[model samples]
Target: MTTENKGIVQRALAGLIETGDVNTLASFLSDDFLHHRSDATTSTKAEWLAAVHAALGPTAGMQVEILHLLADTDHVVVHSRRRLPDAGPEIVVVDVLRVADGLIAEVWEIIEPVAQTAVNAAWWEPARL
Candidate 1:
């Protein structure tokens, strides 16, 4: 079940990135899905899908690279980097998804913009021995 949950999320994310099809992405989500953002705001399935469509509909060159994926029981965690069409700084995102009955029921996401100048190394960078 853990593998299945991971596969479901991977496929959903792949579908969104590859085709930018909100409808296809919607198929993987439950009707009562809720999205919890890092801003302390939450969105329902409809609102979330609408935002996704608005964001992806115009960004044909947007890219998302998955950095790591881990699954335990019904939860799947994904760490990824997104480069939007605006050519701005890349954003690092970590999404935790709860899969229920083969569909994504809830999602919690944290986003951070990459800094051009930083005092320390990026958290995602490989550490030197």
Candidate 2:
């Protein structure tokens, strides 16, 4: 079910940050997996792993906190916030993923700096209506 796919994403994030081993995520990703980033960059599984390695500096030392997760059929969306150790401000990330055969086939992610004054709002919020 879609909820299980959300768990897959959770596991993948934890695996990536905890183990820093791309192969640890094999159970979650399909061989043809594709990741689409906020910058509009698209990459295959290998390419994405390479990028992750470079960005996270080999060990990929990081931690993630899930703020929200939503699943609709084959689509899963996750919103998380995390901060590097004394390095920079907190970063908020929104990841949208598509799962097939119980594995992630595609992903799109939006990353942004969390503004100190920014308040979380929902589209259906009464004030926004």
Candidate 3:
């Protein structure tokens, strides 16, 4: 079911980088998985993990909210929000990923810092996912 596949992607986004979970996260992605970021930077799965580890430290914790998650046979779009420890700013991210054989093969993501006080967290939200 597409929704079930979407659930997998959602869980990956939430728990991928946490302690004792990176390997499980890897299993959800293809070896050639690529991530395209809003900053115009791109990275492979390993590179991404290394980058996050560097930025947030080896043992960073985060809180995630799956605001929206939508999927089809080949792709899923997740609008998720996260707040990290050693806190910088609240971030709202929209990740559009292509899934193949039940694994994420490619992703295009946009991340924005939520204002201290804002009416809507994201740029915009679809009526329904």
Q: Give the TM-score of candidate 2.
A: 0.75
Which ten contiguous residues of candidate 2 have the minimum total lDDT?
115-124
Clashing pairs in 1: none
Give candidate 1's TM-score.
Answer: 0.85
State the displacement of the C-alpha of residue 42, model 3, in Å, after optimal TM-score superposition: 1.2
Q: By TM-score, highest first, what's the ranking?
A: 1, 2, 3
Better of 2 and 3 by lDDT: 2
Kindly list the per-residue Cα lDDT of model 2 for residues 9-127, writing each as its tens digit: 77877777676676777668899999998777899998987776754544555556778888988999989887765576778888899999988899898887776425543556798
Instruction: Report the C-alpha lDDT of model 1 over 3-34, residue by residue, as the tens digit.
Output: 99999999998889888888889999999999
Estimate every model's Cα lDDT from 0 to 1. Answer: 0.88, 0.79, 0.76
lDDT, residue 124, model 2: 60
**Stretches of candidate 2 exceeding 4 Å from the true structure:** 55-58, 115-129
Runs of candidate 1 with Cα error greater than 4 angstroms are 58-60, 116-129
**Sorted on lDDT, highest at the top, how do the candidates line up?**
1, 2, 3
